[model samples]
Target: MRDFIGRAMMTLYFTVCATLKSGAMIVALRDPTWSWARGISVAADVAALGFLVLIVATTVARLPPVKTAQGIEPRLSALIGCFATVTLIAVPGVQTLPQLELVADLITIVGFTLCIWCLWWLGRSFSITAQARRLVTAGPYQLVRHPLYACEAVVLFGIVLRNPTWAVVAIGAIVICFQCRRIINEEKVLRSAFPEYDAYARATPILIPSISTLRELVFPGAR
Candidate 1:
């Protein structure tokens, strides 16, 4: 029953995030500028939506017991809310003259690459609230415990580079803080569910890459 609720809520969350990002991408594509930034933005959205769909589609029966779940308490709180579009929605659509648009485009490609592949590594174990179906130690996981959030940070930074506004900066800061809280929330449960998680974390950086682990590749040897 708890797993049922967890699956449903996570499905809803990822679906909504993908839907919003799809809408934003549609708007960006309509631009006649034929801009490379718009193209990269579209690719990013596609990768993100594809990954989100994969996460939802892969949720199956006979899964491992979830020792921890988020949003199962049925209480509304700021901590429970996820900033799904902190990377995509804050600056939806291409600006007529966005700052650092090219650099942002490149970053978008790099980020979504990390994100999509990390999801691949995570496979069916992925959840919005850190449900531990499996403890992945291969691929990007070897470099960072929360590879998804790490990729997201880079993606959000790219958006900030393009927007470069006080408003965007504030939103990014808030989003980062929210993510930090989420990490703590997730780790608490992970520690209980997976005994080796502490050692894995000790060996892996939280969001940043350790040179030893990261030398595997900038985006991981996988796609």
Candidate 2:
């Protein structure tokens, strides 16, 4: 009974969030002032919204939570990181630095593109909070344990480059701290649910892709 209600509520949450954000993004994209480079931000938003909408699909797919770490810590950490990150990048501040817009835009595009790919790869395994919809060990998962969040970190780094401010620096720091913790909490659930997760974790890096992981692709015992 409680589980059913919880799933229903989550479905509603994702639907509403994805719809509202997508509508706003469409409007923003249609604005005359927005250049093609600015489309990267929209792409980032779409990637996030796409993931949220996919969360609803997980509910419909009836993928049960094999394990979930659902205390305040996991939830609060992710919320704080996301909130801080969004606010720092989205909001305009009083002081603006002389930014290399093209470089920043390119970085952001790569980051968000990777995010979208990973999110799509995850498919129904996607969830905002620390919960295991299912175990996915292919595609981007082969490179890193949490490729979505890893690429998001890259996105935030590019955002900081665009808006180089003390406030942004402080908030981005907080975002990184919380996001790293969110990874731990998420892994707790994945490790709990899938027995094969240990071997996967051993092979892949946590967030950063490394030469060793790449080398292992050929040698299979390079580590």
Candidate 3:
């Protein structure tokens, strides 16, 4: 019953997210100026909508987890980390655009695209919070243990660039800290569920790949 409720809530959440992104895309497309920024915003919205819909579908079809993170702490950390950056919405918009606005938009586009790509690989294993749905060690997982979070960090950095305020920076730091905690909690859950997880973790970088890791990715034969 709890799983059913959680799944329903997650599905509803992603559905709403997709709907909002769709609306944003339409509004951006209909802009009278139709500037480069407008085009980039529309692109980002489209990418966001793509992943959001995928998330909704996957959440509904996801298999039951072998183990879920116990305790309210893990759940709270994940929830806070996921939604903490929403405070940026309350920050006053700056009229004078920073030189990095375009770059930020471009980063957001790439981030959203990468996120969708990762989500495609994640499929039914996707979950907003920490749970060992399945031991996915393929695709982007081959590069990093938490590719989705890495992609999200990229998107979050872009958001900070778009805002470029001290307040936003502070919020970003807070979000990062919470996200790290969430990762820790997730790692514990995964380790508890899968015996091979420890070996995978030892082999894979936690988030950012090391130089050696990148070299290996580019040259699979390199030892």
Candidate 4:
């Protein structure tokens, strides 16, 4: 019952966010002066929508039943709310001049790449909610405990960069705060569920890359 509610809430939240993003893209397209810019924005928005759909499908198919916690984390809820609000505001009001648009495009490319890598890693260890799944400690997981969230942050940052509105920047900040809280909760859950998680956490960096660890993972022959 708890999992059901959580899933429903999450779906509703995403739906709202998607609608806002689509609306924003439409507004951007309607601007006659920025034809090329509008086109690029539309393309990026479409790509983001596609990626979001894939994420929802994959998460639904792969994740285990979400245990009903005491309450929804306030920070997480704030993040979603702020993101939706910003998307709606940004769509109609934010001006994406050519120069800013180009930067956003590059960031989007990098963000997409990171997202894809994280998704691939997650796919390998993914399991259906109905089935029991074990902790994943390989691939991206070997580097950071919350690589997916980090990738998500990158994506959000790219969106903000593309838009660069005060509203969007604020939304991104809220998202970061929410992600931090979510990570803490996830770590707690992992520690409780997996005996070896503590050792893994000790060895792996949370978000940033550790040079020594990266060296070890990438070039085992080096040391």
Compare the candidates by TM-score and give the number of the best one.
Answer: 3
Query: Residues 75-110, candidate 3, lDDT per residue (tens digit)?
Result: 888877766643342232344474577787788789
TM-score of each prediction: 0.76, 0.73, 0.89, 0.73
**Superior by TM-score: candidate 1 or candidate 2:** 1
List ranges where model 2 is wrong by over 4 Å: 1-62, 86-99, 215-223
Per-residue alpha-carbon lDDT of candidate 4 for residues 1-223, written as tens digits (9 for 90 to 100):
6545645655565566667767767776687776665566566676566555555555455565333223457434534644453353235335567788766766665666676677776762432122224577777888887787776677676778777778778767776776566666666666766688899999888988789878987899797
lDDT score, candidate 2, position 91: 48
Clash count, predicted structure 3: 0
CA lDDT of each candidate? 0.67, 0.73, 0.79, 0.62
Is 1 or 4 the stronger prediction by TM-score? 1
Local accuracy of candidate 1 as per-residue lDDT tens digits, 37-68: 56766776676667666666655432664675
lDDT of 2 by residue, 121-144 (tens): 887666656888788888889988
Residue 46 Cα positional deviation in candidate 2, in Å, after optimal superposition: 6.3
**Using lDDT as the measure, what is the rank order of every candidate, best first?**
3, 2, 1, 4
Error of 3 at 172 (Å): 2.6
Model 3 CA deviation exceeding 4 Å by range: 85-98, 165-167
In order of TM-score, best first, we have: 3, 1, 2, 4
Q: How many collisions per candidate?
A: 0, 0, 0, 1
Lowest lDDT 10-residue stretch of candidate 2? 89-98
